[model samples]
Target: MLRLIMLATAGLLLGGCLQEEPAFPNVDLHGRLVVDQEVTGARQAQGIQGEYYKRVLSVNGQDMAFNDFVRHYCPDSNTRNETCIKAFRIKKIDDVSGATRFLPNGL
Candidate 1:
């Protein structure tokens, strides 16, 4: 009887675990953005016209606009510096509008 009770308890626990929702439901939106340092005056004098940086939003390797990424992920833009490395995990993407809904994970 004790063995049967233990088995039932274990089964109940496992069932609960199985039914629980994932931390990021439906889609696992995880990616990194690597922003490079600003070009110095000397570099610009040598004909560097614009900022040199790499922006990547790897939503299953799908490409996203830099502006959209910044708007959604980088809320506190004032604190941003030349060099930045940020990791982001969004909650879900709108199926129809393609809008990104992010989790409360801070920058």
Candidate 2:
């Protein structure tokens, strides 16, 4: 009799666990479409290496297109690369002169 009671209790516990209920709510009855712009080019770079990166920048919760900010700051297209680097908060020049910064072959 005691063994039968134990078996019955275990069966009840296992059965309860096996039953599945919806844990999360499905509020969206209508199908929703999500859209996002694809990211291209280098995400981060410093100085001249960052030239022609063509990447969007985000700063202090504000998003600015790469070329837009670069043109606004530098104005001169020739210095766009340098301006873009500075705008994105990437260090343009190494504080210590004569010291090599980036590795060879864009490593």
Using lDDT as the measure, the top candidate is 1
lDDT of each candidate versus the true structure: 0.43, 0.37
Q: Write the per-residue lDDT of candidate 1 for residues 33-103, one digit (tens) a residue.
A: 34335433445679866544344454335676444554554445443322122322221222222223343
Sequence-dependent TM-score of model 1:
0.23
lDDT of 2 by residue, 1-103 (tens): 9999999999999988873422322221111222112221232232223222223445334565434444555454344343333433322322222112242
Task: Judge candidate 2 at residue 101 and give its lDDT.
Answer: 29
Candidate 1 segments exceeding 4 Å error:
15-50, 58-107
Candidate 1, pairs of clashing residues = none
TM-score of every candidate: 0.23, 0.24
Cα RMSDs, all models: 14.6, 20.4
